[model samples]
Target: MGKKINKSSQNGYHHNNHFSNPRSKTKSTIVGGKYIYHGEVTVEELAGALNISSADILKYLLLNKGFYNINSTLDDEIIGEICLNYGFDFEKEDIVEADDFEHYKIEDKAEDLIERAPVVTIMGHVDHGKTTLIDTIRNSNIAAKEAGAITQEIGAYQKTINGKKITFIDTPGHEAFSAMRQRGAQVTDIVVLVVAADDGIMPQTVEAINHAKAANVPIIVAINKIDKPGANIDKVMSSLSKYDLLPEEWGGDTIVKPISAKQNIGVDELLENVLLVAEMRELKANPKRPASGTVIEASLDKKVGSKATLLIQNGTLHVGDYLVIGTCYCKVRRMTNEFNKPVNAATPSTPVSVTGIDGIPQAGDQFYCFHSEKEARAIALKRAQKLVNKQAKNEGVSILNLHDKLESGEITILNLIVKADTNGSLEAACSQLKKLQVDTVQLKIIHSAIGDVNEGDVILASASQAIIVAFNVHENSLALAKAKELNVEIRNYDIIYNMTEEITEAMKGHLKPTFIDVTYGHAEVLQLFKASKVGIICGSRVTDGTIKRTSKVKVYRKNNVIFEGNLASLKRGKDDVMSVKEGFECGIVIDGFNHDGDIEIGDIIESWGQEVEKK
Candidate 1:
C-alpha cells in the first residue's frame, strides 16, 4: 500500500521527490508558468507527466476521492489539482463531444430556406365549436365519430386554402386534458382561440389564452355560434379584451372573426386570415437537410404495433429514414398522411402517421433522422439511460421540499391542483393557496374543481409536476393507486385554517408530515331501507376494491362528501359480515346518520382508514 496524501495538503507535494523528478517520453510541457495538456488525460498519462508511477496516483485517489484504474480518464478538476501540486498552472485542450443531434442548432442560409405552411392549433372550451370549425375547414366529420361529440385526443390535419397548405392541430377542450392543450400550444406557430358566442369566455377559454401567451404565439379569435339564436358576438369580443386579446376593430392587433362553424358562415375568412398571418411571419425551413420535428401523438395498435403522428417542422422525411425519437429508435417502414393516404415523403409543416417505432414516443417529444441505424440505435440507448437516471433523480416535488427547491433555484413556480367537496370550498382553497406565494416563487393553480380527487387529477399532476390539494374531499381508490404509481402528492385537509397554515409553513420550510387518510373502497347506494332497529340502512353494491366494517365511512352525494364517521354495521343478506368484496351487495349503516332520508339511493359510500406519515 502507498502512503495516502491529504487533498487539502496536495499543494505541499510540489517539492516532493515524486513530482520533482523528470521522466523521459512525457507529452506534457510547461510554458509561460503553465503545464499544457492535450485532450482528456488518463491516470497513467497524468502520472507520467508528474514523473511518478501510476500506482502512486491510483493509491492516493483511492484513499481520498475514489478508486481509479491506470487507464481511467481524469476529470479537469482532478487534473488541475494534481498540476498545482507540481508547482505549475494547468490548461487542457478543449475537447468537444459528438454533436448533440437531438438538440442540434441548424442555421439555414437564406438562399436555402423555403416557405413552409404555418402550424395552427385550435383551442377553446368544450362545446365551443372548435372541432366543428376544423371539420368545416377539412371537410371531415370527425366530430360525429368522437364519443359524446368531444375530442378526447389531439388530432392533426392538413387543409389547402387558395393554393397554400396549412396544418391544423385540434386539441381536446375538456379541462382534464390541459396537458394535451399545453403540448399543442408549444408546437404551434399560431393559435386559433374559438370562443362560443353564446357562452362567451369560459374557464378553458381562459386557460387556452394563457397557454397561447406562454407559447409566445399569435392568436386569432374565432367567435363561433353566431348563427345561433343566443349568439352574442360583442359580449365574446369584450370578454376577449379582458384577457388582453383586443380585436383589431377595437384598436388592437388581434384579428376577431365571427364564424358559424355548423353553418360554414365566415369559415372562408378564417382560413384567409390564417394564411395572411403565416405570410407575415415568413415561416421558412430548409427541406434539403435531414428531417427533425416533434411527435404530435403516438399510440400502439393491435395490428400495426407502435404508430406515431409526426409533425415535420424542418427538412424532408422519407419512408426509409432512421429516426431516434425520445428513447426509441426506428426505421420508418411506412408513412401515411392525415387522411391515411400513403405518402412517400413529407416536408416541413406536414403531419404524417408513421409506423415501425420500437416504442411509443410521448407527445411533443422531438425526433431526428440519422443516416445510419447504428448511430441512431446508439443515441437511443444513451437517451434511454439518461431518462432512467433523470427519473431516479426526480422524486416529484412536494410541499415539504418546496422551500428548499425554491432556494436552490430548482423551481420558480409551484403548480397546484385544487379539489374540494363544494364549489365554495374549492374557490376558498384556491384563493388561500394563491396567497401563499412568496417573492421568490409563484403559485399557479392549473386545475381547480369540486369533486373527489380522481385519476384524471393524478395524471395531470404527474404531467405538470403539481401537487393536488384535496379540501374536505379525499381521493378515490383508483386515484390513490395512480398517485402512488406516478409519484404524485395529494394532500388532504378538512379545515381551511389548517390547510393554509400548513402550506404557509411548508413555504417557509417548517412543515412536517402528519396522518393522511387512505381510501379502502367505494360502494353505491342501490336502495334505502327504514330499519326498525338500526333507524336507517343503506343497501349498497361495492363498486371498487373491498369495504370492511371496521373502516370509517363517508357519505358522498354527487361527488361531494357530506358525512364522515365510523360504520354502524355491515351485513350481507341479513347476516353480519366483516368485509364485502367488490361487485357484492351489502347493507351499510352510518353510526351518526339516523335520518331515513339522509342517505339516498345513487349516493356513494366510501370506506377509508388513516395512517401516520413518518418524517
Candidate 2:
C-alpha cells in the first residue's frame, strides 16, 4: 500500500489510512509535494513506501545509479532520482549530535591555518625506480639495504629543497604490498607516480593510479629511467593519457617530468614541480591544537616494546603526550624523527616514531591526543568494548555465502590473494579474476605473486579476510598448517577456466565441492648416493609429517618447483620402507627425475595428495 498525500493541501500531507505506513514505522512528513524521510533509509524500505518491489528498485539503481545492493542506504541524489520516477519528491532530514569524543573535530578559523609541508608518496611498479628516486632526493642509499632491492615496508623521510621542506613516503612497489600502498596514499597530500620510460606501464602502476585517485589527491608523473637504453618518454606519456593522467605539455593538467633517478638528471626540475603543485594546493593546518594524526606503521620491538611511526596531520605531537589510537592508548615516552634523531615535539606533516604504546596500533588508525591520561584510558576502554560488541554482531567474510552477504549489504568487496606458478600465469589469472566484479559485489585482488603460498600469505589473508587462490601452485607445509589453524580457505586449480568458473559460481552463492592439494610432508635433500638400479638416490631427512612411497612428490630448488612425479622408491638405512615420519633420514628416488645435478643438496621435496572438501 502506498502512502497517500493530502491532495487538497498544496504544501503538506495528512496522515491517513492504517496501511500507509512502511514496515520501518517511521512517519514521513510531506513538504512541497515531497516526502521527507528522517535518518538513514534502505532501498527496501523506500520501495515498500512506494508500493514497489525491492527487485525493481535494485534494477533501477543498477541501470541508472551504478552498483548498489538491496539493503544499501540511498543517498540524497539517488533518492531524488528515484522519487522523480515514482511521481513524487523526497528529501532527507539531517540529525546531528555531539558525543564524548567530539574533540577529534577541530573547527579552526581562517587565521589559524598555517602552511605545512606537503606529504608526498612515491608509488609505481616493482623496480620502476620509486625507491631510487627517493634515494636521489634524500641523498641516501636506502634502496641498497632492502632485501632483493625491493622495499618490504613503508618508509617515511623528509627532504629540504631550496629551504622548503617536503615529507616523502616510500611505499613498496611490489604487488604483495597493495594494502601498504593504499595506506600511503590515504595520508599523502600528493602522489608522485613514477613510470619507467623504458617500461611504459605495468599492473602495479595501474594499481597505484587507482589508489591515488581513490584518495582524491593530485598526481605528478615522473618519467624515470631516462638514462637507460630504450628510454621512450613519448610512449610513457601516451600510456599515462590512457589512465586520464595527461601531461601538461600535452594540453593536460597533470605535470610530467622526465628524470633519471640513478644519474640525478632532471631531479631538481622534479622537485621544483612538486613544490609548485604543493603551493597550488595551499595545504595548511593549525599546529596550536592538540595532535591528531594517522599511524603510518606500528611494530613490537624486542628491546623497546611497542613503537609506532605516526604522521602528524594537524597540531603538534610532543613527548609524554597521552593519546588514544584505535582501541589502544599510549603515553608517548620518546619521539624520534625520520633520521632517528630525538625530538621533543613534531608539527604538522612531520613523521615521527614514538615509543610507549601500550599495544601495537594498526597502520591507518587515527590517533588523537587527550588532555590527561585518564581521558585517553577511558576512551580506549570504551572503544575496545565497542569493538568487541561489533565483532559479535558481524561475521567474517566467507566465500561460501558471498552472494548472501552482498545481498544483505554485509560486504561489497571480496578480497583475494592470488598465487601462480609463473609470471605469465600470475598476470593471466589476475586479469581473469578481476572480471568477476558485478553490480552488487566487487572482486579485489589485494595481493598477487608468482610462487607457492607461504605462511606470510596466510597471515595477510587472515588479517584482510581474503581468500587464497592458487593457480598451478603448491602450498608449503607451514602455510597449509597455518591456513587450517586460521580457518583460511586456499583454493587450488590447475586450469584457469575451472578457477574462474568455480569462483563465479561461488560469488553467486552456488558453492560446490573444491579439490585442494593436501601436503603430506616435506623432506630435504642431504647426500646423493649412487644406486645401481635406481640411478641417483637422494639420502634425505623428512622434516615434517610423513612421506609415503605411493605419494606424488615435487622437487623444489630455491623455493621453485623443478620436478613433479611419483616416488620411485622410499628406503631407510638400506631397508625398504612404506613411509618415513618426521626427524627420520630416508632415501628417496623419483620415478623420472634422475639427473645428477638436478636434485642437489638442500633442495626441498614436497609430497602431496588431492582431497575434496565441500564449500
Candidate 3:
C-alpha cells in the first residue's frame, strides 16, 4: 500500500507550491482613474495585477452593481464598471480575440474528471402539480406549505434513487427556467415536463416545452392528476404529439410516465428512467480542483444577513476557503446541505447553502475559490471601482428602450414595471411573471411596488422603456394622461394567472388572452369611518357567501361596478379577521379609496376577480 499523507501535510505542500512558482509580472498603467489590463484575465489574475484583494473586487460588484462574485469573464461592460468603481477613469485593454483566451482555458483530463449526478428541472403550467410530484418523491409537504399553494421560489434538492444520487432543481415556472438559460448557465441535464391529464396542453405547458427544446435537453413527460375523475392519458398523449414529444408507446423516444402526485403512483418508475438518461449523458466533473459552480438562489436573512444557495458543479468546497462569486467575495464560514445539516466540504452536483458572504449574490452567478483573502479583497475592490464608474456614466439603465431593442433583435430582454394593490399580490405577480423568460429573450422587472399607477411610475417606465403592468390596481387620470403622452403601454389585470398569460403573449409577440370577471361574494355598507389609514373603512354585513380580506373587491352603485380595489383591512369590531361569513358584520377598507366623498354608506360592495376561460 502507498503511504498516506495527512490533511495538514497535504495543505502544506500546496501552500509551498503557491509561494515558489510566482506568476509572470506584466507592466500596467493607472492613469487618472484609468487602468490598463491585458486579454481575458481571471479574477485571481485581475486581483494580482491591480494589487488588490479578490474579495474586495467581489464586494464592489455585489454592493454597488448587484452582480455575482469573481468567477467572471471580464466583459466590456464589466471592465468599464470595474474601472469606474476602482476610481479609475477608463480601462485601456486590448480587445481579447477568441483564440487569445487560450491561456485561461482549462484542459479537461478524462482520468481526473469522474461521473457526477445529473441535475434535473421539473417544469409545467400553473396548478399542474409539479411541486405535488416533488412532495410525493421526497415524502415532504412542500406544495402545501408554500403561499397560495404555488411554488413561488426556486429550490434545489437531492435524492437517492436505487443507490444512485440525482439533483433536482424545482423552478417556479418556464420563465425562471429560461431565465437561467438566458444567463448562459445550461445547468439542467434533463427536463421533466409535468402536464395534467385532464387539462392536457395549456399555454404554460407549451412554453415549458419550448424552453426545454431551446436548451436542447431531453424531456420526460409526467402526466399528473391521473387519479382525477376527468384524467385521460390517451388525450394527453395526443396533445403532446403536436409538440414533438411522442410517447414511447407510440414508437417515439420520449419517455412518458402517467402519475398521480396525490396517490404517489408510478414515481418509482420515473426515478429509474431519470437514472437511465443520466447514465447515457456520462455526466462528470473534477472534484479535486478549486470549487466552481452557479448560484441557485439568494436572499437576505434577518439573522444571517446575506445567504445564498449554491450548486457546486465541480470541485470540493471547504470551510474557511475564500470564494469569489459574480463580483462579490466571501470566506465560507458555514456550509449546510439541503437538509440543513452541517458539512465541512461539498463535492460535484451537491446543493449547499453557505453563509459568510458580504452581500446577496444574484442567482446564476458563477463562483470559484481564491488562494488568499488579500488577493480576493483586492480584486473585489477593483471590480467595485468599475461599477462606480459605470453607474456615474449611465446614471440608471431604463427598461423603456427594451421594445426598440427587441424589434431590432439587438437584445432579447423584456423589461417591465409592476404595480399591485398589496405586498402579497406584488410578490406573487412578480414570481409568476419571471417564469416566461426563454432563450435569449429574458424578462427583467425594472421596478415593483404596492400602490395605484402614479406619475412617478409612468416616468420610470418611460425612461426604462418598460411596459407597465397593473395587478389589482388602477392608473389614475394623471398617470393615464402621462402614459398616453409618453406613448407608454399599460396593461391591467385583476387575476394573477391572466397577467402571467398576457406577459407570456407579449414575450412571444402573440395575441393577448381575454378574461371575464366572476363575483364570489357581496356585502352591504352600513357605516363609514373617516379617520383611518386604510382610506375609508366601510362597516358592512356579508350579504352573500363569504368575504375574504385578501379577495379583490368592487363597489356597486345601482347594479354597476363603480370602484374596484382590494379589501385592505378586514375586521370584526377591533379584532382583525381573514373572512366574514354571510350575515356577519365586518369593517373593510379599500386600498386606493382615500377620498372622503368617493365611498358612502348603503352602497353595495361586491368581491370579485377574473379568470382566463381559454387562450
Candidate 4:
C-alpha cells in the first residue's frame, strides 16, 4: 500500500447511459469505469472479481507481455495495463497504520558482559569420524541413534573440561555448514576438521577446508580412525598440507591430533587442543545482559507443538524469559540441556532446547530476549509483516541472471526449493546440496519437502527467487507451465548421485558444456525381451542416420533422459554388424546400461558421441 490519504468525504460515482431504455434509467447506476487497489492483488483474486477462471487470467497476462503466477503480486504498471485492456480505469488506494512499528534494538552495558565459553563446530567429509569424535568425547552414541546411521541434521552439545564449559556445534556435513553461514549466522568460534587416517582426504573434506578458511576461524585437525589396520598418519598429514593446514609437529601453526574415535584414543588431547584454541582467541561475552543467541535446529513436535535448540552466544537465558526469534516469539516455559536435563538458566555458549516457542523458527535464525512479553510479541508481528512485504517486492530471478549476479563481486546467494520422493531421499538431497558453495555464490535451501512438485512449490520458488530441484519427483502440467512462464529453473533427476554432481558443477561455474554431443543415429525401442546374458535387450529399428558399434547411446522416454552409455553390441538379422543403416531392423545391447523396467515400447534411443576439450 502507498501513503495514506486524508480526504474526509467519499468521491461521487458516475455512470454512462449508452442506448439505455426509459426503464433502465430508473435502475441503480453502475460504477463501470474505475477501480481502486488497496494493495497488490493476485491473478486468482483478479479473476474472481471478473467472474473468470484463473487460467483465463493467466493466458491474458501472457498475451499482454507479462509473466506471473496466480499468487504473484501484480505491480502497479501491470495492474493499470490489465484494467485498460479490460475496458476499465484503475487507481491505487493507500492506507497508513495508526501505529507504525519501530524496530527493537537492544544495547548492552560494559559492566553487564563477561567472558563466556567458545562455540566450536566440527566439520569434515561424511563418515570421516566427525560424529564418532563427538560421541567419543561426550561418551554418547548419537551416530547410532540417527536416521540412516548418519547425522542429517545439525546438533549442538556442551561438555565441561577442567571446570570450563565448551560448546560444540556439529552440522550434518559441509553443505549445512555453508547453509548456516549464508544465512548470516556466524556462531562458530573455532572449527575442528576431522580427517580419516585411512580414507585420506575427500571432495567434501576439501569443501570443508574452504568453508572454514572463508569463515576465518582457527582450524584444529583431528586425524581419526587410527585404530584401523591401514591407518597412515603421515599420509593424512601430507594430504592436508595441500590445503595449507600443515600440522604443528611439521613446524606449522595448525594443531593436528591423532585419535581413534571408536577406541577413544587421544580424545582428551583433542579437547585440550580445542580449549587452547579458545583461549588464544580470548572468546568473551557478557552474561548479565539480555540473552542473544542463534538457533541450531528447529522442528515441529506433535506433543510439544514447536521446539528449537538455541545456542546462547551471549547473556543469560532464564526459564521465564520472553524471546523473539525471527518473526516468532514465546514465553519460555522450560529449558533443557544437551542431555535433556531440566535447567533453570543457561549462560553464554551453551546449547539448550526451549519448549515454549509459538511456532518453529528456522535454523540459523538469530534470537533476542526482551524485557517483557508484550514487547516481544509486538516486535515479532512487525517483523512478520515486513517479511511479507519484502517477499512481494522481490521479483523472480532466472538462472541466466544468476551468473551475472555472481560476477558483480557482491555476495550472491542462491535459494533452492527441494522436493523429493521420500523422506530419506529428501534428507539425503538436502545434505548433499548444502555442501555446494563457492566463495562468490553460496547455496541455501529455503524450503524442502517430501512430495511431488506442485503449484504451491512453484509459487514459493517464484516469490523467493529460488530454483526448484525435484529428485525422483515429477511436476504437474500447471506447475511446469508456471515455472516456464516465470522463467524459474526446475531441475529433475532420477539418480541422487547425478543430482549432487550436477549441482556441485553448477556452483563452480562449470555448467557450461564440457562435452559437445554429436548425434550419430536415432532408433525406436519396439519391444523389450528378457535376457540372461546382457540383463535386458531392446528390439529396435534404425529411424535415421547410421547406428555405429563404437558410438555411445542414450535412451529417451518422453523427452527425458533415462539411460546413457556406450553400445555393448549391435546386430542386424542375427549377424554381428559394424553399422546399421536407416529403415533397417536391428537389435542393440547397451554397455553397463541395464534398462531393467525403465525402457518401454515407443521410447526413442539416440546414438551419439561426445567431444571434450579444456575450456
Candidate 5:
C-alpha cells in the first residue's frame, strides 16, 4: 500500500511536469507587444539590454505583479515594458534592425498564424435580396435578436458550421467589397454569392465574381429567394453560366444551393455546404499560441463593464492573464462566454468576452498577452511613444510630395466610386467630364458598381474616405440612414454622359474654374433633315456663347428642357465646322430626338464651352 501510493504521487508529478514543459519552442510575440523568445537569458542581463532595473525585470515573472501576493506567474505589461524600453517596436512588422532598432518588441507575426475561419462575403445585384438574405439568415440561425446589420461595418461577427468557423466581413459597399477582394488579402477562403432567383444574375453579381476571381478565392453560389413565386433556380443557374459559374448539376465546380432565407428553408443545407468547403480546404488553426488576427470588430464595452471580447485565432487564453491590445494593456480578471458565464479559459477559434481590464477596447483591435502584468504596461507605454514618433515622421516625410501651384499644404485627392444605370449610358456619361479639375487636388476613381449602394461598399468607402456616385440606383434605405448618420455623400444622376463627364472634370480639381480658354454659343433652327424617326437637322445661327463642332448643348422648347447632351455631328451645310462663331449659321442634327420640336428660325439653342481641368 505504501509503494502504490508513492508510485501514484510520482505519476502525478510527471503529469504536471508535462504541462510545465509543454514545449521549449520559440517564445511567440503575443498580446502586450513584448516579443517573447525561448531562451534562458538572465533577467539582470535582459534588464540591462532592456534598460530597466532588476526589480522591474523581476516583476515580469509575477502573475499579478505586486497586487495579488501570487507566486511566479509574471505580468504581461512588465514584459511589454521591457520590450518597449529595449527599443522594440510592436506596432510594425517584426524585423530586428540591429542598427536601426536597438530593442526588439515583436507582436505575433500574422504570417506565422494559421488559417482558421474562411472569410465569406455575400454579394449580388441591387434588390436581389443580398442584404435580405443575409439578414434573414442572421436572424434565424443566430437567434433573431437585434440582428441589425450583423455585418455593420467591415468588422462583423462569426458563425460556426459543423465546427468550422467562418467570419463574415460586412464590407458594406459593393464596390468596396470588390476593392477589398481586389487588394488580395490572402485570408479570404470562400465567397458566397447571393442571387435572387427571380432576378437572376445582374451586373454586380458578375463584378463580385470577377473581383473574387481577382483575389483567387473559391465561390459558393446561394440561389436566394427560392420561396418567391417566380423563384427560378434554373434561370439563376443558367445566368451564372454567363460568368462560368455552372452549377454542380451542370458539371461545374461552383456549388449552387437554392435557399429561401425568408422561409428559413435550406439554411441547414447552406451551413453544411459551408462546412464541406472548409473541410475540403483543410482549414486548421494552432490552438497552442496566443490569439492574433486582423481586428475584425471591436468597441468599448460599456455594458459589459470591462474587458474586451477578443476573437482568438492562434492560442489558448485564460483568466487573470494580462492582454496587450492595440496600444493598451489590461489584466484580465475573468473570462465570460457569449452567455456571460465565467470561463477559466478560451481556446483558438473562440470569442470569449472577458473582464478585469479598466475599459473596453475598440473593435478590430489586435490583442495579445505578455509573460506578466509588468510587461503589459511597459509595452503599452512604448506603443504610445512609437505612435508619437511616427506622427512626427509622417509630417516630415509627406511634405516632399508637394509641388509648386499646389494651394493647400497637403493635396487631398478625393477618390470616388461611381455607380450608374446601364453599360451604354455609363459609357456616354463618363466620356465628357472635361470641366472639373485643378492642380492642387486630383479626383481618383477607386471603384464603381451599377446598382443601389450597400453597406459593404459604404464601409470600404469609409475606410478609404471616398465619395459615392449613384447614377440611377438609389441608396439602400437602411444604408442611406447609416450614410446620413456617417455623412457619406451619395451623388445621383439621370443623364448618362453628364454624370461621367462631370466626374472626369471633378478628378482634375478643375471645378474651381476652367484653366483653358472656351466660350458658349447658341443656334436657331432654319430647316430640318431626317424629320422623323432618326432625328432632325436644324439649320441655325450661333447667337450666344461661342459654339464649336464638339461643344456641349441643351435642347429646350417652351421653357421645358428637352435634352442636355453634346453637339453630335454639327455641320455648316455639307462642311463640318470646327468652330462656329457667335453669328455663324450651321446645320446640326440631334441624335434620338425624332419628334419635331418648336425650333423655328426664331427659336434659339444654348451651348456651354468646356476646357480640360488638369488635376
Candidate 6:
C-alpha cells in the first residue's frame, strides 16, 4: 500500500536539517536566526526541512511565522505580505519577461459561451452622474415588476438593454480607484466617461482617461447633463479632443452618447455601442476552465469575515475551491454575491462576493486557478523563492542608503508621492520636485495625488517603493503608526521649496548641514511676579539667537542638560518679546516652572536653538 500522505506526517522532520534542499541553502546567513528558503523549494519540502507543519509554514509566512491558505487569489496584497513576512520576496520576480506572465495558464473547459457582458465602468469628475447612470440602466432593464429592483448593489449590477446584457462596476471617484487599478484587472470593456457637458473636463476626468488608456481599454463618451440648459456638449467634445478622445461623429473611433440619467435618454445607444466594441474585440471566455482573474475589491468586513468581491473574466468559481492570488492562497469555503447571499457557483464575467481565505486580499489582485490545494502550495513556494532572490539583490537599499544611491548615476532617480490639501498647493509642490536636480539624478514625481496623504496613497507608496511627501496635507493620524512599521518615510512640509530642496539635497548625498546656535543668558524669579504650576515669572538678558521665543530650551540648574523642554513663555517687560539682544535687559518667564533657589540675581543660564538651513 502507498504511504498515506498527511500534513502531520510531513511536518515532523529533523529541525536542524530542515533546509537541506540545494535550492534553499544558498547561504547560511539568517534574518532572524532561521534560514530562509533563498531559492525555490516546495512547501512540503520546506515543511520537512523545518520540522514544522505545512500549515504552520504557511501560517506565519514561513518556518512557523504563522500564515495559512495563502493560495487563494482572493487577495494578492495579503499574499505579498505573507510572502515577505515569511522571508519570501515577490518583488525579486517582478521583472520576469512578459512571456512568463502567461506561463501557468489553465485552459477554460466550460462550454458556456461566456458572452462576457460588456463591462462599462463609468468614470469622471466628482458629482458626475456615474451612480445615476448605472442606476437608471438597472431600473430600465428590470421587468418593472421586480418591485425590489436593486435598490442597492454589491458594487455592480447587470442590466439588459436592446437584449444585450452589460455589467457596470460602480468604481469610486477617489481613494478606491488606485486599489481597483492596482488589481491589474482593469480590463475596462468600455469606459463611459461622464463629462458634465457644462462643466467640461476636470482634472480627475483626465486622470480617469489615463487610467483607462493605460489599461488599454476602449472608451465610450457619455456627455451627461445634456438635459440641462447650461449643458454644452460641443464644448465638452472639444476639450476631450485634447486628450485624444474625439467623438465618433468627429471621425474618431470613440463612440459618443449624450444622455441625462435623470431623463434616462440615449441609454440604449450606450449599451449597443458597448456591445459593438466587445464584439469587435472578440471578448470570449471558457467557463469550463479553472477560474482566474483579478480581485475587484476586498474589505475585512466584520460580519462577512474577509469578504472579497471578484469580477471573474474567465472560468468558473465554485465554493470549496482553492486558489492563489499573487503569493497568498485561500480556500473558498463559501461563494456569495456582493449582497452576502450564498450562491452555488459564479461563472465568467460575473461579479460575486466570496467568503474564505486567511486574510483580506489586495484589490485588483490577479487570481489564478491551480490543480489543487497541493499544487497551489507548491506554486506558492516557487513564487516565494523567486521573491527571496529579488530581495537579496535589493538588500543594497539599506546598506547603500537612498542618499548615496541617488548621488551616483547608479541610482540616478528617486520617486516621490506628492500630495497637498488643495489643487494649487499640489501643483506648486509638484513643480518644485520636478525642478530638483543633480549631476545625474533627478527627483521624479511618480504619483502626485491632490488631497491629504490618506491610507490608499500610503499603500500605493509602499507597493511602488516610493516615498510620501505631504505639502500642506495632513495624513490620517492612524496611518502614521502603520507607515512607521512599514518603514515608509513620510515627510511633512509647510513650505513648498523647503520640501523639494531637502529632497533634492538628500538625493544628491549633500543633505542640508545641521548647525546649532548657543545662547548665553539667565532669568531669575523676581519676587514671584507671577507663579503657576506651568512656570514662574522672572527677568533675564542677552540670550543667543536673540532668545527666540519658540526655540527649544533646556532649564538647567546645575548645568547637566536638566529640564529638556521648550521655552513655553517669553517676555520683555510685559511686552511679550522674543529676544533680549546681547546686553539688553528684559523680563521673561518660564512656562510650567517656578524657581526657589535654582537661581538668584546672577545664576548663570544658557540656551540654544537648532537651525536646519537647506544646503
Clashes of each: 0, 0, 54, 4, 73, 36
* Model 4 TM-score (2 dp): 0.52
TM-scores vs. true structure, each candidate: 0.64, 0.55, 0.53, 0.52, 0.47, 0.53
TM-score of 3: 0.53
**Per-residue lDDT for 385 in model 1?**
58
The numbered model that scores best in TM-score is 1
For model 6, residues 284-342, the per-residue Cα lDDT tens digits are 87665556676776778787678677778766777767676655666787887645588
Predicted candidate 1 versus true structure: per-residue lDDT over 153-253, tens digit per residue: 88899998999999999977433233543333246889999999988998667767755664467999999999988989998888889778999999999
lDDT of 1 at 522: 96
Q: Write candidate 2's Cα lDDT for 1-615 as tens digits.
A: 112211122112111110112233463555666878764567877887777797788889868865454445675668788888888877775432111232324467677688999998898988999888998998999889889988888888999899999999887642223344322224778889998999989876876776566446799999999998999999999999988898889999999999999999999999999999999989998776667788888999999999999999887888878888867898888999988999999999999999998899887677876656766676687677555444423344556766776787766678888999999999899999988755667888877777899876776666566788999998999999977765678888988899888888878888754778999999999999887867899989999999976577899998899988777678898876667999999998886686677689999999887755533
- lDDT string for model 5 (1-615, tens) is 000012122222121111111232223334453444432234544454445676655545433433211112223445455576556743323333211111333244445446667656676666565555655555644323325633334434466666666666445545555443222223456778888888887766766775566455788898888888888888888888877788899998889999887787887798788778977887766554543433333455665565565666555677767676756677778777655688887765566766666445555456665556666666565665555444323221011122221344333555566666776645444444323455546655555656678775565554445567677777787777756544455667787566655554554334444346454767776666664433667778777756655555667676567666555556766765556777777877553343566344455567665554422
Give the runs in model 5 whose Cα sits over 4 Å from its true position: 1-143, 147-188, 199-216, 238-252, 262-264, 301-303, 356-360, 385-425, 428-446, 450-614
Cα RMSD for candidates in order: 19.1, 19.9, 18.9, 20.1, 26.0, 17.1
- CA shift of 327, model 5, Å: 2.6
Q: Model 6: runs farther than 4 Å from truth? A: 1-118, 140-154, 160-165, 181-190, 198-219, 238-256, 276-288, 297-307, 324-345, 355-362, 370-417, 420-451, 459-469, 472-474, 478-489, 493-615
Show the lowest summed lDDT stretch of 10 residues, model 2: 10-19
Give the winner by lDDT.
1
Q: Tell me which of candidates 1 and 5 scores higher on lDDT.
A: 1
Ranking by TM-score: 1, 2, 3, 6, 4, 5
Question: What is the model-wide C-alpha lDDT for candidate 5?
Answer: 0.57
